[model samples]
Target chain A: MQPVEHPKSLNEVTADKIRNAIVEGELALGAKLSEQRLADLLGVSRSPVRDALAALQAEGLVVISPKRGSFVFTPDSHVVDELCEHRVILETAAVRLGITRNPSELTRQLAASCDAMQSALDAGDPHGYTRADHQFHNAIIESADNRALAKSYVLMISPLKALRTHLFTIMTENTDRSLSEHHLVLNAVRDKDPDRAISLLSAHVGHLAEAFRANLSTSQDGKISPATLEA
Target chain B: MQPVEHPKSLNEVTADKIRNAIVEGELALGAKLSEQRLADLLGVSRSPVRDALAALQAEGLVVISPKRGSFVFTPDSHVVDELCEHRVILETAAVRLGITRNPSELTRQLAASCDAMQSALDAGDPHGYTRADHQFHNAIIESADNRALAKSYVLMISPLKALRTHLFTIMTENTDRSLSEHHLVLNAVRDKDPDRAISLLSAHVGHLAEAFRANLSTSQDGKISPATLEA
Candidate 1:
C-alpha cells in the first residue's frame, strides 16, 4: 500500500495558488509580481508569498531577480523550441513505456481524458479543455509507473502549459485542431500502435511551438503581449 | 553573447557543499543529517544548512522527513530500476541529439573524457575515474544544447553517481568492464552510428543496476549497509 501523503504546508499551498494563476493565464506572462500586492491579495503575510515565489522559480514558472524583483517567466522563441523538444523526448518515451507496461489501463485513461476534452470543446470551455488535455498526456506518464519520469515531466510542464493557456485564451488559437490531434493519438494508442501514437504525439506537441512562433511573429512588439494579443 | 552568470549565494554554496558530500560518498547513504552537526562541520549556522537540505531534497539527493528528520537517500531495488530507466531515456535522447547537432564536438569530448578515465584507471584512482566517467556522460548532455534536458539530467544524476561510488569503493565492482563500455559507446559515436551508440549506452547504464542488485543480495542484511558492505 502507498504511504499516507503529508499535508501541504502553507508555503506549498501558496505556491500552488500562484502556480495555478500563472498556468491558467490569470497571471500574465512576463508581468511583474509584487510580494506585497500578492500578500494583500491572498490575505497573508509577505513571508509565505516570498517562499512561494522562490519555489515557483525552481519550477520554471516564476523568475526572481534580486535587483529587479520577481515576474512570471517569459519564453523566447529558442526557449519554446527547446521546451518542445524536451517534451517530445519525454512524452514519447512515456508513451512507449506506458503501452508496454500497462496497455489496458493506459488505453482506458486516454479514452476517458479524450471524452473530457470533447465535452469541454463542445461546451467551449477553454480552461476545461486545457485541463483535460493535460490529463490525457499525464495518463501516459503515470501509466509508465516511473516516478522519476513523472517528476521530471511535472518540473518541465508548467511553462508549456502556461504558454498553451496564453495561446488558447488571448490569441484564441483554434482548439478544434488540438482536439482532433488528441483523438488521433488516442485512436492509435487504443489500436496498440505505439509508433503511430508516439509520432502523432510528437507532431501534436510540435504544433504548440509553431503556434507560439506564429503569434510571436505577428505581435506588434515582436513579443507576447497580453494587451496587444487580446486586442 | 551569453549573459553573465550571477555569483552563488550563501544558500547555494551551502547546498553545493552538502551535495558534494552526498554525491562523493563522504556522507553515506541513508545517514541521518543533523542541521547542528552539519553547520558545525561546515562552520556556518543552521539556517543555511536547513535551506540546503530542502534544496537537495528537491534534487532527490536527500530525503527530508517531518518526524524522522533529513537523511541521505537510500535506493531500493524498485527505485534503482526506475532511476536506471529514467537515465536510459534521458541519456539516449541526449546521445542522439548530440550526434545530430554536433557530431564532431561530441566525438572530440567523448574521446577526451575516455582518455581521462583511462589515465585515472591506470593510476588506480577511483575518485578520478568516477569524475571522468561523469564528464564523459555530461559531454553528451551538454552537446545537446538543451538547457531543460541538461537541468533534468543534473537533478537525477547525483544519486546514481553516489551508488556508483558505493559499488566501486565498497563492493569493488570491476572498473575495467565500465571503461570498456564507455569505449564502445565512444567508438559508435565516432563512427556516426547513433543506433549502435544508443544501444551500447543502454546496456552500459543497465549494468549499474545489475551491480547494485548483486551487492544487495550478497550483503548480510537485506538493506545496504556501509559497514556490512565494506567488510
Candidate 2:
C-alpha cells in the first residue's frame, strides 16, 4: 500500500498512514501501538493519532486492549475463511444483479479492468494491478444499484486487504492466472449467463481461499478442510 | 427494542439510550440532535452522550452533519430498498451455510423462532413479535457462524430498523403471513433442502421489499419499480 499525501485532514492522513503500516507489517500484528510513538513518528498531535486509532479500530485492523494499547490485528484463519465466504456471497449476488441491471455496461467496465490488469502486468506493477482489480469488482457491485450491498461488501473486504498486504507476494504470484479468470468471468457476464457468472465468480474467489489455506498451513502447520475452502 | 438494563458502562448505556430513541422515533428523523439537550435528557454529561452519538452514527442511525451537528438520519425509501436487497442476499446465503454447516441446530433455532412468532401472534403482541422476528433471522445469520456476515448485516440493517420504527404498524400487519412464510422456509431447511430454503428466504425478504415499496409510495409518492423489487 502507498502512503497517503497531505492536504487531507490530519486525522484521516494519520489513519491512512497507520493503516498502511499495519498492512505492510511495519507494525507487527499483535504488537502494541503507542499513541505517543505514532504521533511522534507521524509528526502529529496525540489527539489526532488517537482519532486515527479509533478509526482503525472500527475497521478491525487494530484492536485496543483495555489495560495495554492498540495493536495490529493478529491474523486468524477462521476470520479469513469467513471473509472469503462473505465475498463469494456478495460478489455472486452482485454479478446477478449487475448483469441483470445492465449487462452491456457491466461487461464494458469489466473488460476495461481486464485491459488495466494487462497493462499492470506488462508494467510489472502489482500495486496498480490490485487497484484495478478492486475497481473491477467494485464496478459490478455499484452497477447492482444496491448501496447497502456495496457498503457491506467493502466493510467485509477491508480486513482481507490487510491479509493481502501480509501475503502481498503470494497474491502477486497469482495475478496472471487471476487476470485470465477475470476475463472468463467478464465473458460470462457478457454472455448474460448469471448462473455461469456466479459459478465462475465463486470459483475465482474460491481460488483465493485455496491460496490462503496454503499460506495458513505453511505459516501455522494447522489444517483446513477443502469443504471450508469453498469461497 | 427493549431498554438494556444497567451494569454496562455509561458509554454503552448512553449509546443504547440514544439508539432506542432513534429507533422508536422519539427523536424524529432529520431532527437536529443537540448534545446539550441529549445530555440533559439522559441525565448524563455531554462526553458520554457524544460518544453515544458517534456510535449511533457508525450504525447509520444518526448522521453528524458537519458543523450542523448530529441529527436523526432522514428516512429514505431508496435506503430501505437497498437494505432489503442486502438482507435477501445475506439471508439466502446464510440459509445455504446454516443448513450445510449444521442442519439440526439451525433447524432447532428456526423452529423455536417460528414458535415464538406463533406465540406472539396468539398473544396479540406486536413488539414481542417484532423482537422474535429479528431474533429468528438473526439466528439464521448466526447459524452461518460467520462473524463478518453477521456484523455487516447488522450495520446495513440498522437504518431499516429505524424505517421499521416509523412504519411499525404497517410492518406488523403482515405478521401472520410472515409467520407462515417463516414456517415454510423452516420446513425447507428441516427437509434438508438448501435450494428451497434459499428460494423461500429470497421470497420472504422480497415480500418485505414489496411492503416497503407500497409504504414508500404512500408516504412520499416516491415510485419504485416492481422489477427492482426482486432479490
Candidate 3:
C-alpha cells in the first residue's frame, strides 16, 4: 500500500491502500481483514478505515459480518462465469460503438495499442503486454463515448484484474495464440466492422470459458481461507 | 432517510437517503450536493454522511470533485442509450441462460409475475404493475443462477428504477400493452426457447427506448439541494 504525505484525506488513502491490496492479491480473496490489524498496518485511525471498508463493500469486493469482521470477497464459479458473460456484452458493445462513432481515430489508436502489445510480446514481458491490453480495451470504451459503458468497465476492473493476476502467472503455449487472436481483433476493429469485432470478442470470451472448464478447480481465483470466514 | 437505533452507523443511512434522492430525481443530474446541509436536513453527523457520499461516488450515481463535495451524476443521452443497450445484453443473456438451466421454475415465476402485473394494471396502479414488471424480469436473472449476473442485476436495479419513475408516470396507455409483451416473453421462456425469449426481450427493451425517445428530457429520479455538497 502506498502511503500519502502532507495531510492526506484518511479515507482516500485507506481506500487506495485497500484497493491496492485486493487488486494485487496481497490480501487474498476471503482473507479476513481485521480493522485493528489494518489500522496497525496503515498506521491510521479505525474511523477512516471503516469508511474505506464500507466503500469496498459497496463495490462487491468485500463482505462483512455485523458482529464479526470484513473479508475479501470470494466468488464462486457461477459468479466468474456471469462476470465473463457481462464482459463479453460490454466489450462487444464497445467495439461496435467504437467503430460506429469514430472509425479513423479509433482505428489509429487500436493500431498503436496493437503495436505496443506486439512489442511487449516480443520482449516476453507479460507486464507490458497486460498494460497495453488494458489501455487497448479502455480506448475502445472511450471511443464508444459512453460514460455509462466506461463506468461499467471501471466496475469490472477489480475482478478482472484479479483474474488476470492468477492467469498471468500460469503461462502456457496459449500466450502466443492469444496474441494472434488480439491481432485478429485489432484487424477487425481497424476495418470498422462491428460484426467481425463482435465475433472476435465472442471467441475471446469463449477462450476464457475454455480455460475455466478445462481446469475448473485450478482457477487461481479460488483461494479462500476459512479462517477469514470465521474471523 | 431511515435512522438506525443501534450503534452509530450514519454512513448506511446517508447512502440510502442519497440513493433515494438520486433515484427520485430530487438530486438532478449534475447538480452539486452540499454535505453539511444534507447532514442538517437528514439530521446526522458528517463522518457517516461523508462515508455515504463516497459510496455513491463509487456507484456512479454521484461524482466527487477533488477537495470539493459530491454532485449528482447527470448522464447524457449517449450514456442513456448505452446503458439501455447493456440492459438488453444482460436481460437477453439471462433469458438464454435461464431458459436452458431451469425452464420450469422460471416459467412458473414469469407466469406469476406477469399475472400479478396484469392484476395490478386492472387495479389501476402503475406503481404496483411496474414492480410486477421488475420482478418478472428479475426472476429470469435469478434463474440464471449467476451471482455475477445477480450482482449486475442489483447494480442495474437503481438505474431501471430511476428510468421507470421517470417514464411510468406518463406511460399509462402503454402499460397494458407492455404487460402483454411480458406474457409473450413468459411463453418463450416457458417453452425453453432462448431465441424466442431474446426476441421478445429485445422488443421489450425497444419499447422503453421508444417511450424515452418520445420524452427524453423528463427526468424521473428526484433532485437534491446543491448545498448537500459540503460536509
| Top-scoring candidate (lDDT) | 1
lDDT of each: 0.84, 0.79, 0.74
The runs of at least 3 residues in candidate 3 whose Cα sits more than 4 Å from the true structure, single-residue gaps closed, are A1-10, A170-173, A191-193, A212-231, B1-14, B17-45, B63-76, B166-173, B191-193, B216-231
Off by over 4 Å in 2: A1-9, A170-172, A220-231, B1-7, B170-172, B220-231
TM-score per candidate: 0.91, 0.88, 0.79
> Highest DockQ: which candidate?
1
lDDT per residue (tens digit) for residues B6-57 in model 2: 4777877888877877676566667778899888877889877876787788
DockQ of 3: 0.46
Per-residue CA lDDT of model 3 for B127-208, tens digit only, reads 7887798899889888888766666667755765665564455653387678889999988877778998899999998888
Q: State the lDDT of candidate 3 residue by residue for A167-201, as single tens digits.
A: 44555427677777878988997777799999998
lDDT at residue A199 of model 3 (Cα atoms): 95
Candidate 1 structure quality by residue, lDDT tens digits, A113-219: 98998998888786788789899999989988999999889999999888777755553676788889999998888888999999999999988789888875665
* Winner by lDDT between candidate 3 and candidate 1: 1
DockQ of 1: 0.72
lDDT of 3 at B62: 76
TM-score of predicted chain A against the true chain A, for each candidate: 0.88, 0.85, 0.85
Question: Candidates ranked by lDDT, best first?
Answer: 1, 2, 3
